[model samples]
Target: MNENSSCCTPEDSRHSGGTDVQVGEVTTTYKITGMTCGHCEGAVSSEIGEISGVSSVQAVASTGLVTVVSKAPLDEEAVRAAVDEAGYELVGQGV
Candidate 1:
């Protein structure tokens, strides 16, 4: 088997915009501050999207929620750093 198949594969169900479900993947919702428009969403998404193992990101400015899909659970510090780089604050992981 390919060494990266289990986690690094780019084939993620969340990106398809379909109902299909994928296994062994993890999703985290983060509370973000300082987003007020689509541009803010794009910035936050872009920064988080660059993190290794992250497959998809959806940031809603109105809700201040940035959901991230990845092969494995992300380190909180990494997420915080990414958000900070985008000129925002990662409040914490949501419930």
Candidate 2:
């Protein structure tokens, strides 16, 4: 084995970052804060879309709700990071 090789390595972490989504797959909903317009929704959607497994994203600024569809369950932190990248805050799953 390589001197730097381990059971779980940085390579594994990098490769398993995003989970891919499929049609009619798993759906998850999250609550967000600081969204107040269509542009906000679009920004959030676009950022979350970059995640690997994400297939669809719908964000409602008025309701502060975001829905995501994916092939497998996503890492909450990843979702939070995407939202942060879009300049928003993830309040966590549900509503």
Candidate 3:
């Protein structure tokens, strides 16, 4: 998360082994509130994409589910902030 860190790229920052990396194709699902339509989904997706570690984000408005794929591990605070910045609340998280 350092400003000058060259590890900003998805490939560079990803955790390769051990407890630091959860193992497998790790992904987290977050329940987002206030996403009533595709526009809301787009807003959420855009915000999540700005996070350095995130590889991809898919927001489903019907389910209000945000699935984030990060080449590197992601922090809980980063997830929360992305959702919050998109004008949504993260109601839950699952590994």
At residue 18, give the lDDT of candidate 2.
Answer: 44
- Candidate 3, 23-88: lDDT as tens digits: 554577888877766667677787887888676677776798888777776887888887787678
lDDT of 1 by residue, 1-95 (tens): 11111222222122212223258879888998887766677777878888899888888777999888888999999999988887888899975
**Candidate 2 ranges with C-alpha deviation above 4 Å:** 1-24
Clash number for each model: 0, 3, 1
Task: Locate the minimum summed-lDDT window of 10 residues in model 2.
Answer: 8-17
TM-score for candidate 1, please give it. Answer: 0.78
- TM-score of each candidate structure, all chains considered together: 0.78, 0.74, 0.69
Which ten contiguous residues of candidate 3 have the minimum total lDDT?
1-10
Best by lDDT: 1
Q: What shift in Å separates residue 17 of candidate 2 from its native position after superposition?
A: 26
Task: lDDT winner between 1 and 3, please give it.
Answer: 1
The per-prediction CA RMSD against the true structure, in angstroms, equals 11.3, 13.5, 10.9
